[model samples]
Target: MLGPLAAGAVFFPGLFLVSKGALRVLLGWSEGDAVLVSTRLVSSLQAVMASSAGWIISSSCRDVMEDRHWLTEAYVLFATPYFAYDVFAMFLCHWHKQQVKGHEEAGPNGGAVRAALSGFLRREVLMVLHHVFMVAFCFPASLLWRRGKGDYFQGVLFLAELSTPSVCLGKVLIQYQKQNSVLHKVNGVFMLLSFFSCRVLLFPYLYYAYSRYASIPLLRVPLVAPWQCNLGAALLWPLQLYWFTLICRGALRQSGRRQKPPGS
Candidate 1:
């Protein structure tokens, strides 16, 4: 656990700085674009790395408690704290971004910071909710709820994050005025398909694996989960569904069928 985490702790920050510099140096992106793109790149890379590592570790473990794999435990430990930080940082960034935008709308005297603080969640409710769930439900599941009981299962759930990069890229494409590029079209397709596969389709597998391996029946698995855990798991579908709706809406932007509004 410490190994992957120490690696992530080191890797995430290093990558963020490197990617930000590369974007500015190689592509000459504007400050806003560079920050946005670099952040997305860091998120995508981390999700991919986490998911891949979880799978590889699980494959090697065969039995988490029985194998007594410190590796899986370390991974979960790493992820729990990292995600809590991610949730906090993500909310702050969104808030600040919205605040700055508000500041712009109000002109030089608009008091955007005050405006943003007063109506913070007006634009970031969903993102805020998602991160809150991460800190509340997912963190506990990974660390305390099941504790050592289902570390492997907790890792499996992490794979659902694999689609997030595509989602971020889709937004980045639109933000950077690449709406007409073939890359945008390709990213849109990936955003839709990957979100469905990881967030929608594979949901059942997440539970099914838990049931099959844990010897807990499908109907009874929820009984074992902390009530909050079940809520967290149940919420995943609807939240992703909501984002999927947004993805569909964004896809329409390419076709000139609709224009996206702010805070979407």
Candidate 2:
């Protein structure tokens, strides 16, 4: 467990530096541009790894609550570092963007760093909170609270990352000032679809799966489910719905912009 965790600590930051340097040399992108893209690239890779692990664990399990897969706990431990790393990566990305925008001007010692950190927290408070919750709460729940059961549930939760690549692509397009392009528009639609299906509806699907397995009605499944499971879903589902609505609104705004007259 510690080995995988330590490896992840090394892997993500190492990948970021290597990717940043490669983008700077090979693509001639600015430092800010490279950092932003490299961070998103790392995120997309993590998402792919998670989705793949989810598929493997889900497919291997016959009983949703009783079956265990080696990858379930192992992947969770491996991924734990990613959340911590991403917070720092996100801060780096934010700092670079702020510098590009001149939001951080030369000032008293440490003043610029403090301002950048404040802005980052303000802009990304929800996302930062989400990552923190995953590491602090969800980590222990997956590893300890289940008492070695419900690896299938952990697998399904991992599938929630399936939407991340599209999300990353949308950010990349916006970063390059290409949000008006056809590809960005298409990716916006795809992000909406993927985010809705994979994130927003995921918890309900979990309950439905449990219902099917337990031979109970869908509504009844929640009532009889373990309190921890119910509490976790209750806490997470609303956040997913909130993010989905934000994505939907953003997509609508982009669609509206795309439909306007050229001069307008």
Candidate 3:
């Protein structure tokens, strides 16, 4: 648990820094302005990440309590409300977006609102599916690891997770190469490394927990330690680096106009 917490702590700061820096760069802010805005933004994002991590840790600790039956019941009780809040939040976002655009006049051949809504809905649906799959896969995989039969299966799943990010990186690289943007090329490389680290180190631990401990009879013992959690969170460093690289690349590209230099 300490591991995970530490990882989260370390990772969130870096993630916040990268995100804030990227935003500043994109907006063409000077270094001083970027640093100032990034500082505030990162601080706010850090608070949110810390709060979320606390809730998760607390929930895990509750699950491991000695009063087994009561703990299980408590877990369900708390989880329901938490999940409900998430659902409500999603709805609120959609409603807010609709309200913001409700008064706009529809233009000729303009389906901007529909297009935006459709894209948002699509992305939301995919995000939900991704979470569902993560839970479903992690749960069974963890059980299998605990039972000593999940090694290979977990390996495969880990590979799949790793592959998805690699594919994403590859696509980014292909685009970068086509655009001949040095910044994007560098970003692609960093992102590839980031994804690789996540797939290699983080997924294995996740698989171990999901396969072995999620369903374990004991309520108090965390499958993994906080330190391990922190280590997992460290994956964010590479992720942040990758994101920064991408942002820098995009900013550089957008800041200057260049005509196509040569024929294919």
Candidate 4:
């Protein structure tokens, strides 16, 4: 609930600002750009708001099912598909990024050949490990949530969530620490926070929902303490907003750096 609210406050406003800013930057238009563009932005915001509301309503309904004895059925019908889609999208995006990089490096025919050869290997080998790790972390938490035995399993889930951010942060810290660009450091910090928010907030809620409501042996206990869940969700939006800002800033800085006259 609070998660959705936080997302609304942080992301919705930030999205509006970014889109408006981008339009201004691209078109060199002032506040009096196009009436239609403004209208469309508002419309898009409304759509996002509607979607968030829908999630809240659906989550509430799932909670109700947990209060009853139907959590497992409800979860399977609703949550499982969403999780599947998320995982699939993650892997697909990863694969796409690799392919794009390969194409850029190899150029035209060589790039195409490399991408064709590497794509399946990347998906089946590299991305499969990520999927396996996510499941390994999540499944035990589901068991704990189902059995109402909230102890070490919860800790384990938390650790698993932390693992990804820690790895990512470690890489940046080790490899890019000496890069004195303020933008790079800022981007790294936000990236770390984004990962932290996902681990500390998003993944936990997901696990809670899955364990208590979504799967075959629904635990039906509150996955996390209510206050914690709400707070975590509330924090997610700001983190995402910052993350987006950092990415855009980094891109701008990188572009500027690239365009600078050498030895000038």
Q: lDDT: which candidate is best?
A: 2
> For residues 1-264, could you state the per-residue lDDT of candidate 1 as single tens digits?
456667666666677678778888999975555666767777887688678866766676567444444555566556554554455445445654664565544232346555654566667677767777776767656666664665555556667777888777777777767877898888878878888887776667666766877798888878875676577768877887888887787677657643556467
The root-mean-square deviation over C-alpha atoms between each candidate and the true structure, in angstroms, is 5.1, 1.8, 13.6, 13.9
Decoy 2 TM-score against native: 0.94
Model 3, stretches more than 4 Å misplaced? Answer: 1-19, 22-118, 143-146, 170-264
Q: Which sequence of candidate numbers ranks them by TM-score, best first?
A: 2, 1, 3, 4
Best by TM-score: 2
lDDT score at residue 41, model 4, on the 0-100 scale? 51
Each prediction's Cα lDDT score? 0.67, 0.90, 0.42, 0.43
**Candidate 1 collision pairs:** 1-74, 1-75
Model 3 per-residue lDDT tens digits across residues 1-264: 234434544554465457546866778754433443444344334334433433443344433222122222222222222222333334334544454457543242337646655656675764444345434443333333234332332232323232233334444344335445675456455645644554445544454554455554333323443343334335333453454466456546644434435452
TM-score of 3: 0.30
Error at 39, model 3, angstroms: 19
Error of 2 at 178 (Å): 1.4
Q: How would you encode candidate 4's per-residue C-alpha lDDT over 205-238 as one tens digit per residue?
A: 5555556544534344344345443443444435
Which of 2 and 3 is the better model by TM-score? Answer: 2
Worst 10 residues of 3 by lDDT: 65-74
Q: Name the TM-score of candidate 4.
A: 0.30
Global local distance difference test of model 3: 0.42
Off by over 4 Å in 4: 1-83, 98-120, 123-127, 140-146, 151-183, 190-264
